[model samples]
Target: MSHDALFQLGMDLEAHPAPRAERAAGPRSTTQTEDTIVAPVPARDADDRLDHFIEKQGIRCAGAHLIIDLYEAERLDDLPYIEETLKTCVEEAGATLLHIHLHPFEPTGVSGVAVLAESHISVHTWPEAGYAAFDVFMCGDAKPEKCVDVLERAFRPSRTAVSELLRGREVA
Candidate 1:
């Protein structure tokens, strides 16, 4: 579930205790302030694309080279196989895998970020709904598209949406 939904559910359950309606309500915490406890909410603006958002969020895009967004994989459950398969594909493509991150499934989605020597590979999966998203980026001679093809073959999803990008270029 989304953070909001989970928080709301907790509040609702606390508000209406089961079986014992006469039970006293829990004490409210008055010490927490939004500014002190929470990260600043990002203002929604027109230019909130992935790169821009990443930049705004203070995340360093490893190599500032290639960025590929692959959406519509089968799910997160297929990751172990995908990881093994991707290892071969990445090796063949000349990219080195530094690390892999697999996040828990969320209401928005289950996403994972892979840190790579050439760049990075990020995967997000929704096994319950049979959907996933992936990213492979690299610098120098690493062919990220090969990784994408391997993912496509492994997942065999209904459809795939891809966005390939070359980052860090400047206007002449």
Candidate 2:
């Protein structure tokens, strides 16, 4: 490998591991139950250009998908608002909502996941801690930032980190 190639390889090895949920945890809400539905948001072809952006960003993966995960949420009552916020974002971007789930908590907010054909969006909130956790995965013409706006409006998290993953990798 050339010097630049070797340097690039070294950088990849140093990146931190990504977060993933092993299983859904936390208290379940009774007011609103877990729901799964399919609502595809329509988008213009211009949105299909995400593949080029991903390559330009130097991401190493097989397909185009952006996953956004949020942690340390402090509210659950904000679930409705969060959902509306996300829907607004998805609609604005012309994507679809394949499925959506919202569970209301005891004194605070809600925990749920909006499954999109493009990918999915999830959230967990803790009012006592004044924090919340969220995830968004957008593929193809899907726009993930729209969901993020809803999350920010509901949780107002002080800190957040984003991870971009390339799906459909074939290992031989």
Most accurate candidate by TM-score: 2
Q: Please give the lDDT score at residue 18 for candidate 1.
A: 39
Give the per-residue lDDT of model 2 (tens digit) for 11-111. Answer: 33123322233113422222323455665555548655433233324543333444554455434466667677667766765566767777777876667
- The lDDT of each candidate is 0.53, 0.56
For all predicted structures, in order, the TM-scores are 0.52, 0.56
List, in order, the clash count of every candidate structure. 0, 21
RMSD of each: 12.6, 13.5
Error of 1 at 86 (Å): 3.5
Q: Could you tell me how far off, in angstroms, the CA of residue 97 lies in candidate 1 after the best superposition?
A: 1.6
What are the per-residue Cα lDDT tens digits for candidate 1 across 26-118?
A: 433222222111123244455542223123124333233333334445545754665566576667667656565554444445555556556
lDDT of 2 at 130: 62
Model 2 TM-score on a 0 to 1 scale: 0.56
Off by over 4 Å in 2: 1-75
- Which residue segments of model 1 deviate by more than 4 Å? 1-72, 106-110
